[model samples]
Target: MKNQQDHIHIFSGEIADYWIEDGILFSQSKPIKRTVPLIQENIELVKKITQNQAMPLLIYLCKSPVPDKETRQFSREQLSQVYKAMAMVSAPGLSQLIMKMVFQFQKPPIPIKSFSREESALQWLQQFK
Candidate 1:
C-alpha cells in the first residue's frame, strides 16, 4: 500500500478522507451529516484528479450510512464526467442498497459495480485498464 501511496492525492474533509493510489481513487467516510457544499468539495477533488489524460477507477469504501438525496444526486452528476469505472465496497445494508438504487435509477455514464472486498473491487476495475 505504501508503494501505491507514492503519488497519492489526498482530500480530507470532516466527513471523509479521500486519496488516490495507482489510478484508483479511494474514499472512506465517517458517519457524519453530509451537506451539499461538502459533497461538492469531494467532487471538485475528484475533478482535479481526473483532469489528467488517463482517467482513474474509483474505489469508494463506504463506512457510513447512505448519504442524503442531494448528495447522492450531485455525486452521480460529477462522477459521470471523470470516472472510467467505479467500484464500491460496502457491507450488505442500507448503504449498499442505496448505492445500487442510485445506479438503477440513473445509470452512470461509466461502468459501476459493488463488491464486499477491496481485492475483488480492484480486480474488477482492472478490466477498465
Candidate 2:
C-alpha cells in the first residue's frame, strides 16, 4: 500500500514513490543552479508528507554549469537552508566560485553530502533512515 504523495522527487526531472534500490535517477539535462527553488519547495512538501517518517534525499547534479557566480552562490545558500541528505555530481571546469559554494555546505546542521558520482551519491542517501 502506498499513498500518492509518498513519492520522492530526485530532482526536477524524476520522482518515485517510497524508495527504490537505485533511488530515483535524475537526468543530466536538468538545470542545476536554477533548480534550487524547486528543491526548497519540495523539501517542505516532503517534510510535511512524512511528518511521521523521515527519509533521505539523493540529488543528481549533472555536469551543467551555473554560467555565473551570483546564481551559484544564491543556489548554494538556499540549499544549505533546506539541508537534507543530498549529493551533487558535477562536471569539470565549474567556476571556483561554485566549487566554493559546494564546499561551504560540506557540513551543515542539516543532513547533507556531496559526490561527483551519481551512483555513489544515491547510495549515501539510501543509508539514511
Candidate 3:
C-alpha cells in the first residue's frame, strides 16, 4: 500500500490539492474562495492521472463553505468524466448540505456521497475500487 502522501500533487490554487493512491484520487480543499483557473488546472491534472484507467475519488473539504454558482457549475460539468465514484469528507454543516442539494439537482453521472470522517469516505470509495 502506498503511504497517504506518496502520490500527492500539490496545487497552486486555493481550491484544492490532489493525490492518487491505490487507484483512488484524494483531493483536499479549503473553503470556497477563488476558484477559477485553479479548478481548471485541477481538472486537467485529474485527467492526466486517470488517463489510462478510471479511479474512484474522495474530496476532503476542510471548512469549505457553500460554493458559488460558477464553481458548482464547473464541477457538474467536469467531474463525472474522470471518476467512477466520488466521496466527500465534510462535517454536517452548510457546506455538506449545499453539496447534497447540488448533487440532487445536477445529478452527476457517477455515484457520490458525503461523510463526516476520512475513514468513512475511504470506506465508501473502496466499494468502487
lDDT of each: 0.66, 0.46, 0.70
Reference-based TM-score of each model:
0.72, 0.44, 0.74
Task: Give per-residue CA lDDT, model 1, range 1-129, as digits (tens).
Answer: 223355665777666676776667666766776667887766666666556433546455555555678877777776656677777777756446756756658667678787777788888888776
**Global local distance difference test of model 2:** 0.46
Better of 1 and 2 by TM-score: 1
User: Worst 10-residue stretch by lDDT in candidate 3?
Assistant: 1-10
User: Which pairs clash in model 1?
Assistant: none
In TM-score terms, candidate 3 sits at: 0.74
lDDT of 1 at 28: 71
| Candidate 3: regions farther than 4 A off | 1-14, 32-36
**Candidate 2 local lDDT, 1-129, one digit each (tens):** 112234644223222122333333232334444444554555564555445244455543444444455544554565534334555555443423445655555544445555656667666766653
Where is model 2 more than 4 Å wrong at Cα? 1-29, 32-40, 48-53, 62-84, 92-99, 102-107
Candidate 2, position 128, lDDT: 56
Q: Candidate 3, residues 1-129: lDDT per residue as tens digits?
A: 124564466543447666777778877775666454666776777777667466898877666555567877777777666788888777677446756756757667788887877788888899899
**Residue 50 C-alpha lDDT in model 1:** 56
- Candidate 2 residue-wise lDDT at 60: 38
